[model samples]
Target: MTRRLMLSYVALALLVLLGLEIPLGYLYARGEESRFAQSIERDASMLAEIAEESIEKGNLTALPELAREYAEDNPGARVVIVDRTGRLLTDSAGTIPTGSTLAGEPDIAAALRNRTTVATSTGTNSADVLAATMPGSSGTTIRGALRVTYPMTTVTDRENRIWAVLALAGACIVTAVALVAFALARWITRPLRTLERATAQLAAGRLDNPPDADSGPPELRRLAAAFTHTATRLQHLLQAQHGFASEASHQLKTPLTSLRLRLENFEPYLDPRAHPSLEETIGEVERLSRMVHGLLALARLENTATTPGPVDADAVLVERATMWEPLAAEQHVTIAITGPAAGRVRAIPGALEQIIDNLLANALRVSPPGTTITLARAPGAGLHVIDQGPGMPEADRERAFDRFWRASDSHHDGTGLGLPIVRHLVHASGGQITLHAAPGGGLDAHVQLRPAGRERRFQTIAVTHAAAGHRR
Candidate 1:
């Protein structure tokens, strides 16, 4: 943008220079030519008058000496003297023979007919300005004709010099304009650069360093001020929202636990018919307690920002599988850990453990006995938790990340926040998660993670989380 602005300034300067300089240069050239031609014509008329006196006296002896002296005084000039019959009498520089006939020349012919003419003539080696005049008093009383020729280089050299000076001045002006333009562009854009950095930091989690609203143009200053104010307000709102969710969830836990205990205590005291109602009340309290924890976890996840790092996929799989074996054994189901070592996968701290834990719990809730629940890993393909249980339909899987959404046929008591939490963690680590139908029966929870060596850059996470937050 700076380069573009500078170019625009320079281009405008050049256009203005061309408009003024072109006509000025052309006028100067014409003036130089006109002045040169007049000088030569005046000299030719004076010489013609001098030659008239010598011809009238019939004394030709001093004519050659006068012509030679005049030619020497004027460099690059040629002079010729001719009688009324158009026969040359003397030549400056003596290039032509003494008796040479110049009657065929146009300037000499016109001069002999008692007329003055000034024009330019082009020769093989050079171009010249030729001036012709009649001698021995005008009006067909000519004794001889005198012609003067001067090279065109004198006027052309002057014209060339003026053009060079104009061009140099124009170049200097453009250079100066370019320098000023560069500084102006940088000054105008500084606020935008600061705003860009602030926006990036805000997206990462918080706006620690906001844009400076005191510098640059008035428009940009206003923009920076507005942006800083908006980021601060948004930060405050998010902090307040996360604080409320966290405090409310934590506050509800103690009461719900106490209520469950009190209801269970009532179970033993009540009659047999009331025992069933008491147990139902305790179950509902437990369910409410789990829901509060899920919401608290979500709030914490949204509030904290952590850097992702490499973790051994195979090691995590083995550790988590072993921890879940006892529960599977009690259900008469086998916990099968399979697949090759997947090396290191990138994930936020504690994210992998929670993701695997939630997936395993869901699997175990619906998993049948005598069936194998597989914890598998493959290189580049990431981790998978496959269970031999009833799988979700395509429509339900699509909306599984929506908060508090559950399948209509699901009988298991769940808060329906598991899939949504897994999605947030996966995306925050620059990874992806999806639910697919297992080969024969049950569900496959596929978690795709970036290799640790890859840089953590993910825009999808922000968009996904925003949608999820809105739904919640």
Candidate 2:
């Protein structure tokens, strides 16, 4: 856009220069030609008058000598005398023979008819010439005709010089205009570019600091203000929602606990036929309670800002694997771990643990009996979870990470919130997670995070317990 604006300015300037300078140049040349002709006419008339006087005084020889002197004084000029019957008497430049009948030239012809005339010379010898002719007379008697000619090279040279100056000036003006246009374009667009970056940062949920709204054009400044207003409103709405989810989860847990206790106490007295239905109801209530707790944890993670620090990847994987071992063994499944003893990555507090717990739970839900689940870490702060179970279809991979999404053919009774939670935590910690087909058959989940220099603590045992309780 800036380039287009500057080009538009330069194009308009060029058009204006062409419109103004072309005619100006032509008029200047014409004016110089007219002035040169007028000068020649004046010189011819003066010489003609002198010739008439000399003729009347019977001093014909004096005329030739006067013409010779005039020609010598003014270089590149010619003088000629001719009789009324169109015969040349003398030639100052000696180009025409004396007494030769050569009054056929247009200016000489006009002077023989007793009228002054001015015309440009042409033909082989006329390179560029201005000629003026006048009839020499004495007391109403026309004497011979006098013709004077001057080279027009000087007139053309002056016009060329004028055009050269105009060309230089036009070039300078266009160059200056282009530079000013570039500066102006940048000035107008700089604020817009800055606003664009600020908008992107705001979209990524980093609203702790607002963009400066006072630095651009009036319209853009107003836009910045609007953006800031919208961002503040969004932050307030999210904070309110997070607070409500947290408070609501905490408030509901007490009642849910009471209900579970009541169900347990009443189970002994319930009939055998009614026991399964009662147990199912209790399970549903527990699932709801787990979902609420998951929501609260997600809200907290979303609200929490990730600090720049390292996490103990090795410890996190070891602890999570140990925690899930008892449940895995109950299903006749084994857990395998591989990686360095002290892997490190940049992550928020409790982030890696939450991610590992969710992925491990998700993997356990789908793994077949006696199958081994592989937990491994690689260089570059990468983690992998490979499950020996029926993996989802190719098209369902991305949708699996969406909240409340589950595979249509799956037999597992999952709340379908695990991967979404994992994905959110991974992103918050500046990492990425992807689900792919495992080797042979099953699901493979991969996570890559920024490498950190040293280890730090993880604090997500409460969240893990909450999710685990629901699964059991």
Candidate 3:
């Protein structure tokens, strides 16, 4: 992330530099060329005026010497004199032929037409040259023309120097920007990395090494402090849960042992008439044992160390449906299952199965005879358990997951821990369950499971059972 941020910052900076430099360089070059042209024009006009006065006075003897002296004083200028008929009369550099015609030259032709002309050209030395021309006149009659050529080397040199300075300044600015970007990126990302590592350790059940609250930026520091507080609260809650499970198990053990011993001793002397009551008592003891086991399981699940694994929700539902079929049939309840062919969820297999079993048992007990109880998978990765029993009101639904919460005047003999156990197991698996009214007047229990990668197989099974003959 830091690398990405730095790259983005640099890219933006380069774009800004490009936007500023291109137009500025073009304007600078143009202004330099304009100033060079203007200087050449002004010098050419002054030389033309001096020559016209000298010629008018019939000072032909002084003309060549005056031209030579002017050329010597201004080393950067090329001065030439041309007659009315286009002959080159005087040349500053003697290399040119003495009588070369200047008729075809662009600036000279313009001057002969009585128009001052300025033009630019390139020389053999690869330097820019600005040339200007004006006709020599006395009282508006043209005699000859004076032409001056100035090399633009000095202006070119100044531009190069300016460009070099700009390049150095740009380099320094870019370096400073990069350093600031790096420091800011580190300031932002260092705390986030530390928080991420601390979160991983906490999830692994290492409560001893909570993150330091002093680390990171202001927002991250506040988050770290909040996380520390949450961890402390979680530790206390887990300790209390463990203590409750241990006490509850101890409280249940004595009665379970006495009941088991009585059953064993009474079986040899029992008649067929007394067998039903003994069996009923034994069933209640087994149910008690299951509830105690569920409590312990729930306590273990609450610890952060437990991570749920992938399981087939459809398979779990099918298995529980098969196990409870006989009981549902005896109670005169119709059990039907319907859904997609497969669905998978992440959860503890045993705990999930137990939750399904408990919901099935409770539904069968409360449902009227010949009523249809449906167990269907929801549209996504979830289960829906619907029963034709007296539905819970809104208030009851709110408190339904509390331990030992049973509806008023409920006929079924239940420890009232079924819904709470289901809630705990679902929450541990990172899922949720909701209770509502079923269509056609009954209770609906919705259990949503976390979606997993692989598909699961699902097949609906239906069973018809009578209520009077139902056995635990």
For model 3, name the residue pairs that clash. Answer: 329-465, 329-466, 330-466, 331-466, 331-467, 332-465, 332-466, 332-467, 341-458, 342-456
Model 3 C-alpha lDDT per residue in residues 1-472, reported as the tens digit of each score: 7888777777777778767776677688788878878877888888888877776776756666767877788787778877766677777766567679997888787787778988878865778877789988766687778888878787788788777776777777777878888888777777676667777876766666666667557887888788888978876887887888878887887888787788868977999899889988887787777767666655666553567787777887788888888898898987788876446677765767877776777778767878877776556554676776666666777777877666664555576677787777777777777766666665566666666665453211211221221121
How much does each candidate deviate from the true structure in C-alpha RMSD? Answer: 5.9, 8.0, 8.4
| Candidate 1 Cα outliers beyond 4 Å, as residue runs | 1-7, 33-137, 140-157, 266-283, 311-346, 356-398, 430-451, 454-472
Give the per-residue lDDT digits (tens) of candidate 2, residues 118-171.
887673575967778899876568878898888888798999999999999999
Clashes within 3 Å, all models in order: 0, 0, 10
Cα lDDT of candidate 3 equals: 0.72
Local distance difference test values of all predictions, in order? 0.78, 0.76, 0.72
Candidate 3 weakest ten by summed lDDT: 463-472
lDDT tens readout by residue for model 1, 1-472: 7898899999999999999999999999999988888888888888888787788888887788778888899987887888888888888968889888988987788887787878888844766555544453445588898888888888889999999999999999999999999999989888988999999999999898889788999999999999999999999999999999999999999999888878877866789998878877777788789899999999999998998888776677788889999998999978776666666778899888888787777777777778877666544434566666656677777888888887776665688788889899998988887666677666666677777665453211111110111111
Judged by whole-model lDDT over C-alpha atoms, candidate 1 comes out at: 0.78
Q: Rank the candidates by lDDT, best first.
A: 1, 2, 3
lDDT of 3 at 429: 74
> What lDDT would candidate 2 get against the real structure?
0.76
